[model samples]
Target chain A: MLKGKSILEPMDMTTAELEEIFDLADEIIANPPRFAHACDGKLLATLFYEPSTRTRFSFEAAMLRLGGQVIGFSEPNSSSVAKGESIADTIRTIACYADIAVMRHPKEGAPRVAANSTDMPVINAGDGGHQHPTQTLTDLLTIRRRKGGFENLTVGLCGDLKFGRTVHSLIKALSRYAGVKFVLISPEELRVPDYVRRGVLEANNIPFREVKKMQEVLPELDVLYMTRVQRERFFNEDDYIRLKDRYILDAEKMQLANENMMVLHPLPRVNEIAVEVDSDPRALYFEQAKNGMFVRMALIMKLLGIEVE
Target chain B: MIVNSIERGIVIDHITAGTGNRILDYLKIDTKKNTIAFIMNATSKKHGRKDLIKIENVTDVDLTVLGLLDPNATVNIIENGKIVKKINLELPKTVTNVIKCKNPRCVTSVERNAPHIFHLMDAQTREYRCEYCDEIVSMKNE
Candidate 1:
C-alpha cells in the first residue's frame, strides 16, 4: 500500500504502514540474500542538495545491496542545480531517469515539492530543521529491536531539541503509541519548538517534562536520544560554542542509566558523546546506522512495489 | 456618524478594532475603481469597538482570506441595498498564499513560485501551521 508514496514525514505513513516497513526490515536482516534482487533493473537517484556522509552512503548502499543501480550527485554543485535549476524542474528530469529518488535539501519541504513534481516516489533524506522521517524510521527500528515495543516507554531526548529534525519527527511518530512519556532534556536556548511542544506532544495529551539537566532523567528513560548542537544550524558561533558541550554523555553519566536502556544518536556526532561511551553495550548508534540501510532497503522495495516471499 | 449602505456589494462587520487596514490590504481591492467605506473604531453593542468595510458595487472577495484575517468578522452580501446572504466567518481547514511562511528555512521562502500553504492545526487556538516547515502562526486578533 506504501507503493508510489513519498515519505515526506513520519506521520505520512500510518502505524500499520510503519509496522509493515519494520517487519520487512526484520525479515531483510534475518536473510539479506532473499531481498537482494528485489530492486533489480531499478535505479535510485540520490539528489543531495546539502553535504551528507551517512544518509547518502546508507541510501546508496541500500540500493546497491538490493541489486539496484545507484546514480546521483553528492552535492548541488556537481549537478544542474549549480546552474540554478529549480527543484521542480530537477525532479521532473530525475523522474524521467530514476524510478525512485531521495533528496536532502537545505530548505524544508523541498522533497515535498519534488514529490509533487513527479509520479516517481521521493523520500525525504533530511530537510532544513524540519522532518527527517528516515532517521525516525531507523530510530524506531532500533528501539523496536532492543525494547520490543514503544508502549509505556520513557524516552529521553537530550541536547539541541530545537533544531533537531530527527527529534521532532521521532517525538511525533512515537506520540501515536500509548503510554509513551518524554523527558525533554535540553538547554533553554535549544528547547523543542512551540509547534512540537503544543501541536504534537501536548495536542496528543502525552505526558512529558522539560528539564535542563540530563542526570535526573537518565535513570527513568528506556531510550536516550542524544543530538549534536549543529554548528550549521546556528548563525552565531558564540551561541553554538556555548551550547555545543552543554551535555557530554561520558561513562560516568552512563552509569546512572538503566541497564537495559539503549543509547541512540542520528550520527555525525560531534563532541556530545565521549569516545569511551561507544564501547558500552547500551550504545546502539553504530548498529543504528546499519539498521538505517536495512530500513531504507525495505522502504525502496515497498515504494517500488517489489515484494519478496 | 451615518454611512450610506451598499447596493450589489459586500459589507464586512465586527472586525476587531485596529485591524481594519490589515484586512483591507489583504483583500487587495482597488480603491480607485470601487466605492469603498472603511470605518474603524466604530462603537458596537457586542464589542466595545470594531471596524467595518462596506464596498459598493463589488461582491467578489475571497472569504477564506477574510476569515483568516479576521475570523470574528461577519460578511453580508447586498443586492439593491438589501441583505441577500450573510456569511458567518470560520477558520478554513487550509489556505493557499494567504499567510506567508515566515520561517526563513521554509521552501516557500526560497521558491517564489511555491504556494505559501498553511493548514489549521488547532481550531480552538486559531493556530495554523506552515505546510512546509510546520511553524505555528496564531490568528488570534490583537
Candidate 2:
C-alpha cells in the first residue's frame, strides 16, 4: 500500500503502514545481502537545496546497498537552482531521470512543492525545520527494534521543542500508537508550538504533561529523546547562558533515569549530551543514525514495489 | 446609522458579535476616505448573533479574506440600495499577502521577496493553508 506514495509528513503513513515498513527494515537488517538488488534498475535523486551531508549520504548509501543508482546535487549552488530555477522546475527535471526523489530544502514547504511537481514519489528529507518524515521513520524503526514495540511506552522529549521538527514528527507518529504518553521537558520559551499541541496531541486526547526540568520526569520515561538548544534561537546572550546548562544530559542525570530507559539524540550534539553517557548501553543515537539507512532502504524498496529476494 | 447606502459598495452582514472590530482592524477601513458604517452586536432573524459593516463609494471588498476570517459573513453590494451584487463571502481558492503564517520555518515567513500565499482547502470550514509551508491557519485562533 506504500507503493507510489510520497512521504511528506509523518502522519502520511498509518500505524499499520509503519509496521509494514518496520517489518521490511527488520528483514533488511537480518539478511542485508539477500535484498541487495531490490531496486536494481531504479534511481534515487537526492535534491538537497540545503547542506546536509549526513542525510545526503544516508540516502545514497541506502540506494547503493539496494543495488540502485544514485544521482542528484548536494547543494543548490551546483544545480539549476543556482541559475534561478524554481523547485517545481528542478523536481520536474529530476523526475525525468530518477524513479524517486529525496529532497531537503531550507523552505518549509519545498518538498510539498516538489511532490506536486513530479510524477515520481517525493520524500521530504528535511524542509526548513518543518517536517522530516524519514527521520521519524528511522526513529520509529529504532524504537520498535529496541523496545520490541511502540505501545504503552512513556516517551520524554527534551530540549528545543519549539524548532525541533524531528520532535514534532516523532510526536505525531507516536500519537497513533496505543497507551503512549509524553513528558515534554523544555523551558517555557522553548515549548512545542500551539498548533502541534492543539492539532496533534490535545485533539487526539493523548496524555501529556509539560515540565521545565527533565530530572522530575526522568525516572518515568521509557525513552529520552534529547535535542540541542542552539544559542541562535535566543535573542539575548544572558537568557541563553541562563538556560544552556539546565537542559544538558550528563552521567549524573542518567542515574535518575530508568535503568532500562533508552536515550536518543538526532546528532551533531553540541555539549548537550556528555561524552561519559556515550558508553551507556542505552545510548542508541549512533545506532539510530545507522537505522536511517536500513529504514530508507526499506522505504525505497516498498515505494518502488520491488519484491525482496 | 445613515451614511448614504452605496450605489455599488459591499455590505458585510451576519458577522459574529463584536468581530466587526477585528474585521475593521484587518481591513484598516478607517485609513480609506470612503463612507463606512459599522453596526456591532445587532439582532437578526437570519443570524441569532449578527454585526454589519457597510462601505460606500467602493465596488468590491476582498470577500476572500472576510470569508477566511469569518465564513458566516454575507456580503451584499448595493447599487441604489437595491442589492446589485450579493455574495455570501465564500472562501477563495487562493489567498495572498493577507495574514502571516506563524510557522517560522515557512519560506513565506522568512523570504522577504516571496509573496505570502495561502490556499483555501475547506471552504465551509474556513481553513486556509500557507501555500509555502502547508501550515493550516485556524481562523478561530487568528
lDDT of 2 at A241: 83
| Position A264, candidate 1: lDDT | 95
lDDT of 1 by residue, B13-72 (tens): 999999899989878899988889999999999999999999998887877777778778
Poorest stretch of ten by lDDT in candidate 2 chain A = A227-236
What digit string (tens of lDDT, one per residue) describes model 1 on residues A1-309?
899999999998999999999999999999999988888899999999899999999999999999999999987887898888889999999898999999999898899988888999999999998889999999999999988889999999999999999999999999999999999999999999998999888888999999999998899999999999989999899999899999999999999999999999999898889999999999999999999999999999999999987
Point to the candidate with the largest lDDT: 1
Q: What shift in Å separates residue B79 of candidate 2 from its native position after superposition? A: 17
Q: What is the lDDT of candidate 2?
A: 0.83
- In model 2, pairs of residues that clash are B7-B79
Q: How far out, in Å, is residue B68 in model 2? A: 2.8
Residue-wise C-alpha lDDT for candidate 2, range A1-309, written one tens digit per residue: 889989999888888888899999999999999988888888999988777866889999999999999999886788777777777777888888889999988878778777777779999998875688899988888888888999999999999887787888999899988999999999898898765786689979999999998888999999999997766556689977877776889999999988899999887688889999999998999999999999999988888888864
Please tell me how candidate 1 rates in CAPRI terms: medium
